[model samples]
Target chain A: MRGAVMYAPGDVRVEEREDARLVEPTDAVLRLSAACVCGSDLWPYRGIEPVGGATPMGHEYVGVVEQVGGAVKGISPGQFVVGSFFASDNTCEICRSGYQPSCPYSVIMGSIGTQAELVRVPHADGTLVPTPAMPPADMIPGLLAASDVLGTGWFGAVAAEVGPGKAVAVVGDGAVGLLAVLAAKQLGAERIIAMSRHEPRQRLAREFGASDIVTERGNEGVTRVHELTGGFGAHSVVEAVGTQESMMQAIRSARPGGHVGYVGVAHDVSLPGVELFFSHVHLHGGPAPVRRFLPELIDRIWKREIDPGKVFDLELPLDQAAEAYRAMDERRAIKALLTP
Target chain B: MRGAVMYAPGDVRVEEREDARLVEPTDAVLRLSAACVCGSDLWPYRGIEPVGGATPMGHEYVGVVEQVGGAVKGISPGQFVVGSFFASDNTCEICRSGYQPSCPYSVIMGSIGTQAELVRVPHADGTLVPTPAMPPADMIPGLLAASDVLGTGWFGAVAAEVGPGKAVAVVGDGAVGLLAVLAAKQLGAERIIAMSRHEPRQRLAREFGASDIVTERGNEGVTRVHELTGGFGAHSVVEAVGTQESMMQAIRSARPGGHVGYVGVAHDVSLPGVELFFSHVHLHGGPAPVRRFLPELIDRIWKREIDPGKVFDLELPLDQAAEAYRAMDERRAIKALLTP
Candidate 1:
């Protein structure tokens, strides 16, 4: 099987690797149907995050179960399934509390590298949610999106408490942020503001239900959000960029008693405790418990109620994985879908 | 009028000040019945927080409305009332949202000096909540407690989402934290863990319905909380100490989906964003918004359902304000009430 691997900064290649197989009693081997490059992947690609050696890449996928371990239940061969980047036993106390990413027995799906011809998933019964039926080819991208981005965006909206009559502000223009706008809209937010200066991203944001757009950044952006909301900042803010500036903007852009749902992978960020305390805002975020929203997302995708797949602006064969990474890294593509 | 003044570190004196009068159409002059020294006041008294020359001290007070401004509607002269340290117009958008302390027109009651014979309260109609009747002399302490500590503790418990079946952990042993234990108990928390090493405070905590007491500090304290909660941290954590160590302990002592309500006035503290993000805990807090809980707290105190005033271990004439501050500063008294 050929899989994407990174040897060093800006060094990505598609190479032959050992075929994946069921490794545990609760494992399932999946035949990859679709995989994609994520913005987070750019961390190591751009050398912002160090790479030890050759590392298998990719964690988002939607595929058919090719083989199931003897101990696996519910999931079986020939079933189309979607799984979160984090494989959780869904029934644990933590998972039951809707924080599957922090589940004690969870496994990182990225380690298995879903961007390959074949991949092995552990805790199959708990990790994989099967579709009601084999999804059509046109639904593949949306299903793949549900594996992480869509569910993540949904979690961000839920964490921010975006609801009816809420004025929600999104602080990033990435796929997750755009999708967050969609999620907030779907969650019944009365007004959705997308902070973006990029034309293309801004357009997508509007299409995703953003009622307004602020082309400013940092403090100016926060001021604009406040100005748009009558001097009281937005009631709910979704922070998809984990930089210090973005986090502060998100925190500062919320009104007192507001909520901030931050999903960005934080880097070298320290929040001034005094400001956060005085902000009087509720803050909750992390690597989203994507597994918690997979089922509902899959249903919405199946019903064509949402087209999160639109986030993938480019698609290529799995053998062109390096190009996919480059396209996403260079901002040439919002996201790149790979087909094996 | 005579008031407590902090001229320098450890220099507290009873001195003459301007007599209180209604200056604004919405203001009221209150003849203070009782004023208590707060843990926060120790910051400046101990020189942790800077003090300007001859700063009029004290913000916690229970009193009788001596006069009402022309615009004051709800409150009347001769009424026994309780007000938060921050006076807000209660009708503003922020106040309506239950964050009165952050109201656009909010005024700090301490600036007028509550530790005096008479003090002017601005926005009287919105800031003061009158008791059902003049609270009996014996109930004055409890009503005074509601003016700040009890209300703050109750806010912390509510912010922490304390409810039936939830395990609550308190991160301070101060009067506010002890009252938080009481608040959690009243909020229906099934188990309350008071983090305290002091024998008297621990005993008071238990009397306030603390089901367990963990004397360990920092990481070790978090470990004890986890051990007590089946290796998962408590469901709710109230952070009543603003230090970095206490903040981290409070965050670390909560389960993945737990809530952390922090109310201590944060000093030089900055929370690492990455750690907070990955904590997967809901964090909300600030200056307590005591006005939000004043009514209920006053009612509870009046009915003798809760005895939060028991936290005051010392009483002195208003002229001995210096001694009152010294006793609280030296920890010789949990709290000291001053009567004029």
Candidate 2:
């Protein structure tokens, strides 16, 4: 089997590796059909974070079950499935409450790494959401998107309570932020404000149902949102960049008693308690519990109701894993899908 | 008219001042029936906040309208009313969206000082909620409570989403915290845990429907809450204190995907962005839009269903305003009520 591994910053290589096998009774072997590079992957690729010995890469994937352990009841071989970044028992109290990311028995599938020809999925029965049948080739990208970005964006919109009659502002123009515009529209938000300086990303935002666009950055962008909202700011703001500037912009763009749903992987950002206290904005975010939305997202993709895959501006063969990482890290591609 | 004025830290004087008169078309002059010292008043009294000359003291009040401006249609002379610390127009978009504390034409009623025989309330139509044909003599305490602490506590409960089947943890044991226990009960929370060390406050919490009490402070209190909830934090946490420890404890006491509603007047508290980002807890707080809850609260009090005023442990004549402030500041009383 071949997998994506990083030896150091800005260094990605596809190397032959031992094939994954069922080491636990609840684990199942999966042959990945599709995988992708994530925005968070750039943190280490750009040398912003520490990278030591060879580290397995990628956490998002959709695949076909090849072999299953006896304990896996509902999921079986030949089934098409989508799984989240973290594997959970789903029977735990936290999973029952729909917080699979913090599941007590959770395991980071990233350690096993999805960007490979074969991988072991732990707690298969609970971690994987099986599609009704084999999806068409055209549905691959959209389903793969649901494995992480789309589902995370949906959670961000839901956390911010974006729904009918809401004026929603998004602070990021990445794959997740673009998908969030689609989710907010699906949830019935009347006004969608997308903040993006990139022409291509802004065009996609418009296609995804953004009612307005603001190219200004930081506090100026917040002021523009207030101007559009009659000086009261939007009802909900989504923070997707995870930087201090982006978070503050999202917070400031919301009206008093509004909600700020931040889905960005917080890196070096810090928030002053006094500012948050006086902002009067509800703050909710973290590593999104994408498993919670996997079922519904797969249904939507299978029906061709939404084309979240449009976020993948570039695609590559699994062997070209290094090029895919470069394209995303250099901002040449919004997202890159790899066919394994 | 005589009012309490703070010349500096630890310097409070009862001095004669000019009587308040109608300043705006929506203004109403009220002969105060009662006023009391509040926890927030200590901000400037203790010199944590700067004070210039003799600053007006007190904001919580229930009073009889002595005069009304021509445009004040909803309230008239001789009407007894209960209003919050801020006077809001209630017609602005923010107010319409239920954040009346940030109303476009809002004014801080505290600046005029309620600890006087007569005070002017602006935006009378939107600011004052007239009592049902004048509350009974004994109900004065209850109505005064509704003016600030009771209404704020209710907002905290609502923000925390306290309801049946949920475990609620309260982070403060002051008048507002005690009242939050009452609000949680009214909202049907199944279990109420009050964090307090004071014997009298703990007793008051029990009387206010606290099903359990934790005497520990900070992290220990959070641990106790987790122990009470089977090692998972409470579903809802109400933060009634504005210190960093209390804020962090409230956030830590809630389960992943839980809600924390904070209402303490923040002085210098700050939250680490990374910690909050990973907590996966929903945070909402600020100066509560108390006007939004005034009608329902007044109705409940008028019907003799809730006696929130039990929090007032000290009663003093209006002339002894200094004593009222001393009782609350010295922690000798949970809250104080003054009669003119």
Candidate number achieving the greatest TM-score relative to the actual structure: 1
Candidates, DockQ: 0.90, 0.72
Displacement of the residue B159 alpha carbon in candidate 2, Å:
0.5
True contacts kept of each: 0.88, 0.74
TM-score of each: 0.99, 0.98
The complex in candidate 2 yields a DockQ of 0.72
Least well predicted 10-residue stretch by lDDT in candidate 1 chain B: B295-304
Model 1 ranges with Cα > 4 A deviation:
none
Task: Please list the C-alpha lDDT of all candidates, in the order they appear.
Answer: 0.93, 0.90
Interface RMSD of each: 0.7, 1.3
Top of the candidates by lDDT? 1
Tens digit per residue, CA lDDT, model 2, A1-340: 9999988999999999889899888999999999999998888888988887899898998999999998899899999999999899999888888889889888887778888998899999999999999998889899999988998899899989999999999999999999999999989999999999999999999999999999999889999999998788999998898888999899999999899999998878877777887688999998888999898999888888899999999999988989999998878999999888
As for candidate 1, its clashing pairs are none
